[model samples]
Target: MRLVHVVTLVSEDGAYGGPTSVATGQLEECATRGHEVTLLSLWRGGSRAPAHIGSVPLRTRPARALLPGRFTGIMHPLLVGDMWRSMGRADVVHIHAGRDLVSLTALAVATLRRKRFFTQTHGMVEPRHRLVARLFDRLYVPLLRRARGCLVLTERERRAVSEVIGPQGPPLLTLPNGVRPEHDAEVERGPRAPEVLFMARLHPRKRPDAFVETAALVHRKLPGVRFTLHGADEGELPTVRRLIAAHRLWGVVSYGGALSYAEALRAQARAAVYVLPSVDEPFPMTVIEALSAGTPVVCTDTCGMADELARRGAAVVTDGSPRAMADAVCEVLTDENRRAGLVRAGRRAVAESFSIHAVADRLEEIYRNL
Candidate 1:
């Protein structure tokens, strides 16, 4: 199979978080399986190119139009023609980031070429959109309808997109992100002291403040317990820092900066309870990674992972409230039998469902069908 993966950016250090990691993992696996793969990405002329990716051919082109100053918004019409010519040689064209100019160009190119195109919509165009963005989408809807299939990261997103596009909505397929298992062998067990960990961007919707307040509440009863926060700030860091300082939780609550995939796994391996504490999310890969690390998770029932968590039997899902999250974490951490059961279930879930190779098999089937 010959496949072309089109994304505006690819982070090699695993610094950009889950979506990048998932795409890289899947593309690399496809390359390893003796399939021909090509990567077309926007390369800002002065920026450094990735040093290596074995056996995969790559093409880098300068983005035609830069909008919001630094971001790629719309591609030049001529560039879309160039992209179409490139896709003419491939069996499949997979667009990873659908909001970018490269993606829009790919969609247009795929339609004109009558090529097999598949799109992975990370999240539906951030609910509130600029007028220009909406205009672009209106123009692109027809192209989306012509796609071989549309891939949605979560079931909710699939349903929402179906409603928006109606009969013209391309055949929707929901595939959850895949994660590699962190621990190959049994990790050394230590005396489990209950500690809560929150790992996500400090964005408004992530509700990091709620996580902190919940941690304070949990600390009142479990005096020795600690909470560790990870991930780079998006905008809510200042508020979270203020709350942490005012509470004099400088010692009990620590902020660990964004980490590599290995570092995140190490943190998850040490945690007694992993808390997502998100107000809303679209199929978080972190929740799956925490489960893969054999840690019990406490997350909102409103998120994409809620149903999966219940089915996996690795987490306690409650309402999207700090108090609810705290209570769930406390319940799991305080009971040895319950925690142990969750750990066992979580490991089994990852091995059976979320493993990279396991997901790649499903993806291969999709590619064949396309």
Candidate 2:
């Protein structure tokens, strides 16, 4: 099977967030099973792209991809020609997000060409989006309903999307994200200077402000505790920096902008607790990475992965507030026995539920059906 992934961004760009990461994982699974795979993304501003994801071929083009109503990762208009050409070559065009202009272009092309296509619901059609965007989604829902199948990362996302489409929903397939354990050797997680780490993009939706506020609250009680925020400086970095400076959190918190996976793992290995304060995360891959690294997680109750983490005894889920998050982090940082238990359970959870090989076998079954 020759599969083409239509997404806003590819991993080559520094903004390799959840969607790109998930796509890369899926592509790897497909390719390793001997399926010909290619990723087509609208190239925005990035110095370069990664070499390849497992065995999949990756191609990105610069184009004007955004229109008036969408917040697409790739909004390059110059790439329409390339998108059409790529679609022509693919056996199945897997569309990742629908709000983007390039995605709309792909939707139209897939219809015109009578091609088989699938769309992965990365929680785009959620209630959290803007009113105007939600209204636009009313118009966009039918196009998605026409797809051959829809891949959902979590049951929460599936339910949210199903509410809108109801019985008319496309063929739904639930596939969770997989993790390839970063640490080969058993590296014990020790209490370092920075006891907690936030290893995700510094964006508004990620609720980096909450992280800043929580860190301040945590510092008030635990004066010696340290927090490190890592990931790329997107548009929200300035605001986060401003908040940190205004609140005088300079000494307590260190801003480590966008480290590579290896660098992120090094940071994760040192920290005792991993904190993700994202406001609307469907499922956080970082939580799994943290668990796989034997680091306990302190995340929001609203997180989809929090349920899984709870079952694994690898995380403490708090209310979606700075104070609550602060308390959770403090608890995770101080409780040695709980931390040790979570670390052991977290590693086991990763091995059983999120291992790459386990996830690959599941995805291969879906590919065969598709």
Model 2 worst lDDT run, 10 consecutive residues: 65-74
Error of 2 at 282 (Å): 0.8
CA lDDT of 303 in candidate 1?
82
* CA deviation > 4 Å runs, candidate 2: 11-13, 63-70, 127-139, 182-193, 232-239, 260-262
Give RMSD to native, each candidate. 3.8, 3.3
What's the TM-score of each model vs. the native?
0.84, 0.85
lDDT of each: 0.73, 0.75
Tally clashes: model 2.
14
Candidate 1 overall Cα lDDT vs. reference?
0.73
Q: TM-score of the candidate numbered 1?
A: 0.84
lDDT of 2 by residue, 42-90 (tens): 5545465555655667787664534553245346655666677777877
Candidate 1 wrongly placed segments (more than 4 Å): 12-16, 42-49, 52-65, 69-88, 112-114, 125-130, 182-194
Shift of residue 173 alpha carbon in model 2, Å: 2.1
Candidate 2's C-alpha lDDT?
A: 0.75
